[model samples]
Target: MVNIVENIRKQIDDAVRNSVSKAVEAGELPEFEIEEVTVEIPKEKSHGDFSTNIAMQTARMAKKAPRQIAEIIVKNMDLEGTYIEKVEIAGPGFINFYLNNNWLYDSLKDIQRLREEYGRIDVGGGQKVMVEFVSANPTGPLHMGNARGGALGDCIASVLERAGYDVTREFYVNDAGNQIEKFGISLEARYLQLLKGEDAVEFPEDGYHGEDIIEHMKNYIEEHGDKLLDVDSSERRKALVEYALPKNVERIKKALEEYGVTFDVWFSEQSLYDSGEIEETLEYLKEKGYTREEDGALWFKATLFGAEKDEVIVRNNGVPTYFLADIAYHRNKFLKRNYDRVINLWGADHHGHVFRMKCGVEAFGIDPDKLDIVIFQLVRLYRNGEIARMSKRTGKSISLTDLLEEVGRDAARFFFNTKASGNHLDFDLDLAVKQSNENPVYYVQYAHARICSMLKVLESEGIKVPDVDEVNVSLLDKEEEIELLKKLAQYPEEIRLTAETLEPSRLTRYVYDVAAAFHSFYNACRVKGEEEEIMNARLILVDSTKIVIRNVLELLSINAPDKM
Candidate 1:
């Protein structure tokens, strides 16, 4: 809960307010109500550690040039008790605060005190949220898109939990409606062809053509010996689906669990229809005048909610559309279960569906803002400078299982999370498995391993990492040492930023930058041959870096191997 960056920002804000008040009391500037003060890290270090544009913001009220106002505020500024070493007025109207090394020392101490909890914050206020992702159809194996979604959704949930949210990860199983109907048809064709030859059966043009269907039928026949061949076509298809659907769903679960993702809920779409939720939701929509009858179908007035066209909720044959079922499912999340917020991770093709779903929620008298849908683009896996689509092991299209088999789980997660959700990713097969610094995950893990190795050698000679109070932290004044400490101090702020943006890629980039800083420090400074006091101080610093790196890796569901 201790955010060092936020603390420093608060300190600077109080100092700025007190300074302005003193200036007004001393008659050095006109009296006016001050709005909320803004503080941010300066993009360029030459400006200062932190900068504010309060003077520019107050220019009109003060009736003076911004530089004049800034100078007046600075002259009356009191730097006592604040961590700021000095306050300077920069170009036009900005106030830049230079901090002493004390903030860096406190950051190091906090890390040692909090250990695994160093980067956790309370920005979410413990709001309950449900994150549903990688809800691939149960008719087939999960592919590359599901792989990426699983990584992003899991990481996003972890970040939210760290930010003090009551988070639940969910996977919606599409085991009903049109997809299942097509699945049954596909299995029937495959089964009839296996029994009566391919020429006797006509496969539906829209049925699933993947070899998995054929395998399912083969396995079924091997067990039953054509017992269902004399049965009705509908009954035969029903038997095939009953035998295969559960197996496919189980395979999906096994693959995801192996990839280090386990959901809190495995929701079934069929449950909505079975529980009469779909009918209840449509009746509610009809009561609200958002629906109409046209062409023997029930239509929704989507244009009233910013959509360019209307949508059909139910077909003429009395079967509800998938969109209607989706509305019912969300209703269960909000109205039945009472979650404070709900987030859905969808593919890029569902971009248009976002607004319409939100509209559906509003039509039912619920606030649409409670729902958020994030759309992620596709990923292209590259091998030896060409697109790789087939799996050598499965002899079919590459799946999440195939990806995990080729590259380890850690590489798959880290590489998939290196970019934001909206951006397309080009995953390179060669770089992911490389053990060298060319690989970012390996580079970060190597930093942790390097520290572990250093600490091991030191402990062998009876030189253990000392406590913060035992080490003289002021002795760490080298350029690289200060840079590394500064980087260490940024962990809490980075966590806050990543949570605010709902982007785990930001956190991934933060750890990579920290590793880079540590490498630079290790090359420029000598921890082993330094003086006794400096060695102890550097040891504490090195161990702190190791802890932060491992913390982030654990958050990402990646391993921090000490030996590697």
Candidate 2:
């Protein structure tokens, strides 16, 4: 929870403002209300530790050139008892503050003090948040899109939790919709084709064509022994659905669990209809004048919410649409369950549905802004420099199970989240399983493992990791050591940013950067054979780096192996 980086930035911001105030009081510059002072870390080391553009921002108000304003502000600055070692005016009146390495040293102590609690920040203030993702239709096995959504949604929920949110992971089961209806139809046709002849029954064109349907029917006949042969078709289909839907749902649960995703709620869509919530939602929309009955169908006025057209909530047959159930589901999340925020991760195909769903939420008097839907792009699996689609074992499209078996859960989860959700990801099957540094997951885990191995060897030689107070952290002034400390200082701010932007990929990149920094430091600094004081200091640094790497990997639900 101790964010040294943010604390330093805040201190600099206050210092800048205080200097501007002092300049005004000294009659060196005209008095103007400082709206905001922005402090940023310089990209180039020669530029300085921190940079600000306060001079340029105040130039117009002070009626002076920016460089002149910069000189006046710098002249009035009180740098005593602060981390600022010196200040310089760079190109175009940029005020760059070079700081002593005290902040990095303090960050190391903070890491040693906080340990696993290092990267946590109070950004959410414990607001209740529900993240619904990978709500794939339980009609078949999950595919690559579902895999990506699972990784992203789980990591986002973890990031939110670390950012102090009371988070709930949920999966909205589409059990009552047309998809389930088609599922039943597909199962019934498969059952009849298996029990009777394959040519006897005609499969519906819109029914599911996956082999899983046939497999389900086969298992059902093996268990039930043609007991449904004498039953009516509608009743038989209903029975088939009753037997198979839960199995498919359970399979989905198992796959996601194996991929390190567990939901706090497995919300069933049929529960809404069974509890009359869907009807209540429709009635609520109608009472609010957001709906109208036309052509014997109930249509929602989506255009009222800036949509291009109206949408039908119920068909002429009085059957509710999936959109209506979705409204009811979100209403349950907001009104019934009373979550402060509801985040949904949807696939690219649902891009157009995002706006209309927001409209539906607004129709029920809920703030549509509270409903955040992330539409992630498609995933292409590549192997041996070619697009790989089918499973080597099943000869069907790759399922989550197939992916886990091939590249493993860590590789699957890490690779799926290596890119932002909005970008297209081509999962490299070859690199994912590789043990070399070409694989990012392996590279990061190897860094952690390398540290663990080093510590283990030191422990065997009776050179244990020292406490922060036991080491003179001032000795960590090497470039590689400072770089690693900077990366360590960034973990808390990174989590805050990830929570704010709802992008877990930021943490993925941050962890990789940490690994790279640690590798560079290890290559340059010798931790064990140095003098007692310096060795203890570098040992503390190495241990802190190990803790951060393990924390990040654990947050991502990836394994941090102790040995490579």
Candidate 3:
């Protein structure tokens, strides 16, 4: 059974093609024509679930008035045995298809069998994709802000994976940079104070001022006392700086895993320099003519290709800017691996950098479309209506670990899951922690638990559940029953749209929609066995609803508890 959207799109496409053929035969249109089939969801439910502008688009070439052409197209639409209950022409000749109930009822059973495979499509086909996100500088624990990017990247990857894209999740670690240097200097200050028993710790200028830095340094001193203290102050400081990069990275890694993120690749910035790839990429760019030099330093003439100004690749001091390493990282993701698509989930603070990066990629002659960037806006977490002003450098920022504990993983994921990725999100702890229906997480999970409770009770009474293929779905077509079935039927379209837009909120929202429908059905309708056949039919609907609920919850990495 094909999805309703795809099924209808095919028939509409065929109809439009036939309309064009008729016009061409009448010598009113060209022998061959080009047009896009527009199968869009209509804004007004009275119109139809989907509206197509195919007739309007073909009118120009066909030399027919748009409305006149629309009728010709609709007449050719082969709606036999298909779900279409009616097709209407409106708004300068758009074709809208309204589906019937049997199609909706049958969809519920198909979705149940598909479960994990539900809402999935081959929009990405077998194309290889790499999604790099939450790649914060590995110099501290992940802040609540950075954690937002992690959740988004991980969730988007999940969406793409479900859409049949061969997607790889990656984290780019900036381990060999200025931030790491500052991290070490701050830790060394505390280390010296503890080891030499100085009056107090004096943090270096431009160094970390976090309370965690002092604690991390204190731990280092207690374990390995004065090991580098024999060297000059500056030399020992450099040594501490070198050691603390790995130290901070290890801490960041533990926190990310604790926050429920698993990366298939954790790419290091230093590795680019070490493996000669950074130099290699620079030389490649130079050869390709996107470079320049001034004031005894090497620069890239990015402005020649529309950048605000040319950018420095290497300083007079011979150190490459962070920009150089990033160019190399993106090159490896695109040129070396030949991924069908490369997506970077970046924080909005770096929004200004989009042009220069895209310029550099296109300068290489690769398709610019292959590289997509999704920017995550800032997050403000409110506890009792007070704003949380937390930062990694100040140690005042809320850690992802603390968040998981306070709100629990299910709540945090659901809170993050509900909002659009690009919009600034407000995490209201008061609302999220509520145990009753006020909490969206509790509501969805509660629906799952109630169905499980009903199932367990039925099992205890020795009632048998229907197999998906054996489901007498036509028997489940009561008004409330078919309404729930319609929601289940929407899974494929939901997954397809989410994958197409690279937005997981659509999928997340659909989960809540289905849950609400189930809850309403639960309150209004009963499913018990004084009458076995009807009871079995209702059981199939509830069980299928449960499968759809668990499927979406898994995508968000939120659990669907069987019991409240």
Q: Tens digits of per-residue lDDT for model 1 on 441-493? A: 99999998998998998899988988888788888899899999999999888
lDDT of 3 by residue, 280-355 (tens): 9888888978788889888988887778888888998888888888788888888887888999888888898877
By descending TM-score, how would the candidates be arranged? 2, 1, 3
* For model 2, the run of ten residues with the poorest summed lDDT: 1-10
Worst 10 residues of 1 by lDDT: 494-503
Question: Which stretches of candidate 3 lie above 4 Å from their native place?
Answer: 1-4, 22-32, 197-201, 233-235, 390-395
- Every model: Cα RMSD to truth: 1.8, 1.7, 2.6
Per-structure clash totals for the candidates: 0, 0, 2
TM-score of each: 0.96, 0.96, 0.93
Candidates 2 and 3, the one with greater TM-score: 2
Clashing pairs in 3: 390-397, 391-397
What Cα-based lDDT does every candidate model obtain? 0.91, 0.91, 0.78
Deviation in Å, model 1, residue 299 alpha carbon = 1.9
